[model samples]
Target: MPKTIIPFGPQHPVLPEPLHFSLTVEDEIVQEAIPGFGYVHRGLEKLCEIKDIHKMIQVVERVCGICSKIHALCYCEGIEQMMGVEVPPRAKYLRTIWSELHRMHSHLLWLGLFADSFGFESLFYHFWRIREKILDINEKTAGNRIIVSVNILGGVKRDLSTEDQKWILAELKEIENKLEEVKDTLFKDYTISKRTKGKGILSAEEALYLGAVGPVLRASGVAQDCRQLQYAAFSELDFEPVIAQEGDSFARMQVRYFELFQSIDLIRQALSKIPEGPISVKVKGYPEGENVFRVEQPRGEVFYYFKANGSKFLDRLRIRTPTFANVPALAKMLTGIELADVPVVILSIDPCISCTER
Candidate 1:
């Protein structure tokens, strides 16, 4: 069979971000796939040198709109560690609550996009509708919907009041009920299963060798999650990593679908056990050394490296987003799959080119 090269992105109806993939196909089956980047670069990391460390918090939140709070959380925690500032207990719980809310919304957004990738338009709309509630919670509590700038160096800038917590819980309950209603369609629907099950199989070994993270790694039956690091109030919470053995598109969807409820449970746990105290602490000195921080984002583990020189501005800032780590696994999964299934498989990894290229 003669080989053909097909460009699969940079502007596809199914991709939420701009990601380009060179697909080499033989008789409509993918023989190899090479990913391309550099389509979206904001130079946010480079701005650290010019922007004050405090101002960079808002900048980091723009790394990826969907996982904004987690990015800011990772950056803030790294800076706080280097400065020897401990976050208040109440602030820690508040951070956890907001972080989980971000996670739920991100996953819901991905789920909706995933459904759309395979032509499930109604399912897509349904998922996004449920996601609006989570975004509303963010706007109500943190003062913004997507890029909620709630994280600060010492702790969180916003606090959830008693009435706010009650309202959030009530909203979450409704979201949970809505998710349950669509659970069958997401998992058992013939079309979804046909488009997802056993497609883009990335075995456990492939996942680790390719450095997969987040749902992509979990779907491969890896029980590793950065939340196990005990950051924020995760140390006080109890939950298990959602995993599946198939390591296919269906498995990836399953892991994310189940994680929606897990995030809700985490928010509930944090709110229930939240202690009363100041939301933020005063930092006394400038950071002088370098430190690394990792946080579980909706997509995967986001790594932040901070270098400081006892000055107001950071010397250097580096970020390793999960999409960058998962690109290799994506290429591996793409190989040996039918070209028609490309969109389904690509979206399965939940690529965020903005996060990757930034």
Candidate 2:
């Protein structure tokens, strides 16, 4: 059989991020997929040399717009650990609340895009509409819709008031109801199932071997989540990693779908048990040691490595994004799927090229 190589994206209608894949195809089925990157690389990590440690928070947030809060949180937490700062109890709960809200919005955005990938336009719009509520919550509470910039070195920059908490809970109830209405259409619809089920199947062993993270690893039944490490108020909350055995595109979608509700529940728990105190503590000195921190973002585990020299600038700031870890797994999943199924399968891991290239 003659082979053909197809270039899939750096730009495509279905891809929200810029990523290129050299897909070798025999007839309609993909034989091998070699990924190409560097389209949107901004050298974010390199900026740590020039930008002060405090300014790097805004820089890290730009690594990916969808889950910016998590990036900031990871960076701040790492720095705080090195500086030996104790975040106030209220600040920890506040950070957890905003982080989960970021998770909800990120998952909703991915769900909408996933629907669009399979030509479910109405479903896409429905998910995005629900996502707008989460964005609104970010804006009302943290002053930005996407990159909230609420996380600071020792804690959070903003605090949720009593009235704000009540209003947020009411809004979450509405979002939960909206999600219930679409549950059947997303999981039980014939078209969605046909497009997603059994497509891009990756085994649990393969997922771990390929270093998959976040929902991609969970969908393959590895039951690992950085949240289990209990950063922020996750230590005080209760939840389990959402997992499925199928390791297919549909399983990936299911993991993310269930995580939406889980994030909501986490927020509720944090707000209910939130203690009264200052949202942040005054920092007396600069970070001087080396530390590594990991946090569960909407997509997966984001790892941050910090090397400080007791100066205003960091010696090194290295970030290992979830998408970077999941890319090899994505390549593995793409090898045997049909060319027509490429978009959805690629989207299944929710590739964040900016994060990867950063």
Candidate 3:
């Protein structure tokens, strides 16, 4: 049989983000996968040099639509550190609630797309239908579905009233019940297991060396999660990182499914412990010096670096997104797998090309 090189995609049905791979295949087995990035570069990082620190928050949030809030949160945290501003306790809890809410929405979105990759259209619809509830919550509270800019430098821009909190409690309960129903079918379904199990295997050692983050690293039983760093309100919440030892596509899916419930539990905890106080403190003075902040985003660990020379405009701003870190893992996972399983394998990392390019 002759060896052939096939382009996996700058555009494809299974991938929502643009990622190109030159796959060398022989007898339907991939020998090597060469990756190409920067398809959607918007020069977001460079814009920070011209944009003021406050305006840079909006630009950073647009780095990845799925995890927009987390991006803004990381940027705000870094800037706050540089300015030595202490966030209100209420604002901290609010940040936790919105972060977990976004996590749930993001995981659900990935689940739907993962199912769609394997041709489980019905499951895809079921997952997305439930996701709408989360979007509705975002719109009702933050005034936007995806890029809800609730965070300012000192604290959150909006507050969740007692009545609104009660509504959220009730809504979370309903979403929990709905997820339980799907959970039963998702794990037990023979088709899903057959397609996912033993496919795109990534060992624990390889994952750590490649710097895999979020569920991808968790699935390999690494027990490492950025959330455990006690950032924001996570320190106040009682939670554990979900771990699985399989290190395959199925294990990755299981890790995310478990995280969905974990996020719901974390949200409930935040709501219960939320103290009565102002949502924001007055932010004064320009940021001075340099600092870095790391947050556990839906995909994995996202790092933001800020350098301010006592000015309104940042001297330098850099973002290290999870997708960029996970690309090495993606390349390793593709080697020796069946070419047909490429889409599903690539999706297991939940690569966001926009975030990578930014």
lDDT string for model 3 (270-356, tens) is 999999999999999998887888999999999888788987888888899998999999899999999989999999888889999
Global CA lDDT of candidate 3, please?
0.92
RMSD after CA superposition, every candidate: 0.8, 0.8, 0.8
What lDDT does each candidate get? 0.91, 0.92, 0.92
Residue 179 error, candidate 2, Å: 0.4
| Candidate 1 ranges with C-alpha deviation above 4 Å | none
lDDT of 1 by residue, 2-86 (tens): 9999998788888867889999999999999998888898888999888998899888888888899999989888888887788
Candidate 1 has its poorest 10 consecutive residues by lDDT at: 8-17
lDDT for each residue of candidate 2 in 31-106, tens digit (9 for 90 to 100): 9999999899888798999999889999999999988989999999888888789999999889899989999998
Once fitted onto the true fold, the runs of candidate 2 whose alpha carbons sit more than 4 angstroms away are none
TM-score of each: 0.99, 0.99, 0.99
Q: Which candidate is the best by lDDT?
A: 2
Q: Where does candidate 2 clash, by residue pair?
A: 214-300
Q: Going through the candidates in order, what is the number of backbone clashes in each? A: 0, 1, 0
